[model samples]
Structure formats: C-alpha cells, structure tokens
Target chain A: DAGITQSPRHKVTETGTPVTLRCHQTENHRYMYWYRQDPGHGLRLIHYSYGVKDTDKGEVSDGYSVSRSKTEDFLLTLESATSSQTSVYFCAISDPGLAGGETQYFGPGTRLLVL
Target chain B: EDQVTQSPEALRLQEGESSSLNCSYTVSGLRGLFWYRQDPGKGPEFLFTLYSAGEEKEKERLKATLTKKESFLHITAPKPEDSATYLCAVGEGGGGNKLTFGTGTQLKVEL
Candidate 1:
C-alpha cells in the first residue's frame, strides 16, 4: 500500500519467449530495486537503480535486464524466458540513504510461470 | 560473504501462544537490521528496523530486538492473523544500499 503497483500481477508464458514486467511507484522515491523470490534462495536482488538512467547489476543479473527511464517507472526484461526463471518478482522503493532511513517498501509482487 | 540465517523454518502455534523467531547474521559492518512479514503470494511488509546492537522496536503484539550478531522477533499472544513468513535482513555499513536477507521462518497460528 505504498503507492506502488506492479502490472500483470500474474503471467504464464512458454520458454524462449521475451517477457517484461513493469513497476510503477507514485511516491517518487529515489531508489528502486527488482528482486526474485525462490523457495530456498529467499529474495535475490536482480537489479537496482539509483536514479533515472542510473542502474547497477545485482547478485543474480544473468539473462535479465532492467531500465529506469523516469523516476516512477522501472522495467525488468527477460531476453528469453526459461523455466528456471519462473518465480515471484518484487519491486521495492526507498529513499537515498543507509541505516535507518533506508527502509524499503515493497510492491504486491508478480508471479511468473514459464513452461 | 554476508549471510543471514533464520531458525525454525516453520512453526505452528495455538492462538494466544507466545513465541520468538531468531535471525543470525554475519556481515562486514552492520548498519541496520530489519524485520518483515510476508503473507502468501504477497510482497514483504516492513515491520521493524533496529539501527544498532541493543536496540529494540515494537508494534502491536510484535517486538524486535537486535544484538551484535543476532536479532529476535518476539510475538506475544499471537492471533490467527499473525500467520505469515517472517523475514530478517541486514544492511551493511557505508553506502551499500543492498540488503542480505534470510530464508525466513513461516509461522502458523490456529485457534
């Protein structure tokens, strides 16, 4: 309920197809992150953006890409989806800082299924 | 490598039962520790944030305490609505805005 919304809350697609997910935030936070949640892996960061057009790769950035063209919109793209990428994706926003001021607010999440 | 481990992968408690979940972490420099609750098919919701060792915070029937190497999330007289996956994360010191999270402890409260 942090004014964050993810589009296509659920999706099912075949392998080798391209997929893109969108995360939009109304709060206009400075930091944005994309993460994937798996059963045993917890939540792994996929990519993060510090500002519009400024992005960095995370621990598991393989086969995935992200773009932040504006302050409120961040997009995650899968060049060629695979069954291994089937998981719940979450988007988070936070103010620019560390320690106590860096608490992240998460969106509802997108469940992706690849066959 | 920064690591966080949560104990008791799953816990079942009767309504009004009090219990605690543990989160142990190892990081270069501990900037802050966070507690989150995530329901099934939903994103994690922030519950508490502890800035340093010996720090504590509470909300409703939940309390979070932080130590140098570990943190505890104590639930008092839990209700059925308290059932969810509790996640703990550590934010490293300096300007690293990244967070390392634990696998989380799933708690189920029944009447």
Candidate 2:
C-alpha cells in the first residue's frame, strides 16, 4: 500500500524446509517491521529493524529471524517451517517523529502455506 | 502488558446503515492510535491517527475518535464499497517504534 513490496506473493512449502520472505520499501523510512496475520490472531509482530544490521525481536519472534543489510530491504527467514507458521506475512515501514508516534504503511503481504 | 481488543469480530449491514466499530486497548504509555482498512487479499490501508484522548479525525464517510481507554470508528451511510476489515493498532514509546494490533472487525455491507 505504501512504497513497500513483498516478494513471492504466495508460496507453499513443506515442514522443516527453510523459507525466506523479502520486503523492500522504496520510501526508505527509518523503521521496518515484519508481521504475521492469522485467522483469529490478527497481526503479530515478528521482528523489526531500526537501522542497517540493527534488528530486534518482537511479540512473536520465536522460530523466525530477520536481517537488514540495507536501508531498503528487510528479510524474514523461517529456519524450519512448520504448520503453525503458515500465515499471511506483511511488511511495514514507518518514520517515528519527535512526537514519538507514527503511522506505519504496509506491503501487499505474502501468503505462505506450510504442508 | 500492552494489548488491544476489538469488538464484534464481524458485522453485516445494509446499504446506508450507520454503525460504529470499537477498539479497546491498554498500553504502557500511549503515543498514538491508528485505524486501518484492509480488503481481502490485500495489505492494510491507513485511515487515521489519533494522538490524544479528545482528538478526532475524519475521512469522507468515516470518522475516528479516541478516548483514554479506547477508540471508535464511525461509518455513516456506508455503501457496499465500504465493506472491509477495519484494524486498530497502538503505538508505544520504544526504540524500535513497533505497533501492537487488534484482531480487527470484519464489515460486510450489502445493497
């Protein structure tokens, strides 16, 4: 919706396989985040990057990892995919101003199905 | 712990019906509250941002109001095109500037 774009719009993988979802933002905002959306859980934060190589875990960071080697790209990796990990993944970007509040823009999302 | 909860998980309305969606939340220290509209198979689209309890924002057919403990999204004379899932999130003061989200309320408007 913003200038964000997620790669592999849809994918299906088997259990124990490694998968990586890519999120690229043209806005070049200072913050980037990864989130997963399920039927009843809504969107749960997975990881976020404040700057290049500066990453941190979020509410639901277990079984997942993230890396940001550049300002425009943030990647989420599933070391070993599980059925529980199957969900729609979204990437978001934000610029937190001096007021300490921000409205994040989101990417189209990548739907992953684990078998 | 900071958390968010939305009421009426789903809604069905007739064209021109006016209604309100509720988002209740508790945060460490609220920085802002946000409202988003999401269509099926798509990412969320930003709607409004409310900073203080007395603040209110408006779009064409939607109005958002904030309070100390919750926020409300009011839809007036909604059209079928207004049907979509509305999501609410809270921004807390932190280093990473992350947002905590609610499950969302799905709205269906039929003509």
Among the candidates, what TM-score does chain A have in each?
A: 0.96, 0.95
Q: Give model 2's TM-score versus the native structure.
A: 0.97
What lDDT does each candidate get?
0.93, 0.93
The digit string of per-residue lDDT tens for model 2 on B14-97 reads 999999999999998887899999999999999999999989999999999999999999999999999999999998876677
lDDT of 1 by residue, A1-115 (tens): 7899998899999999999999999987889999999999999999999999999998899999999999999999999999999999999998845445678889999999999
Q: Which digits, one per residue and each the tens of the lDDT, describe model 2 over residues A1-115?
A: 4689999999999999999999999867888999999988999999999889999999999999999999999999999999999999999998886353388889999999999
CA RMSD per model (angstroms): 1.2, 1.3
Worst 10 residues of 1 chain A by lDDT: A95-104
Give residue A42's error in model 1 in angstroms: 0.6
Q: How good is the docking of model 2, as DockQ?
A: 0.79
Docking class of 2: medium
Q: Could you estimate the TM-score for every candidate? A: 0.97, 0.97
User: What's the C-alpha lDDT at position B56 in model 1?
Assistant: 91
Those runs of model 1 whose alpha carbons end farther than 4 Å from true positions after fitting are none
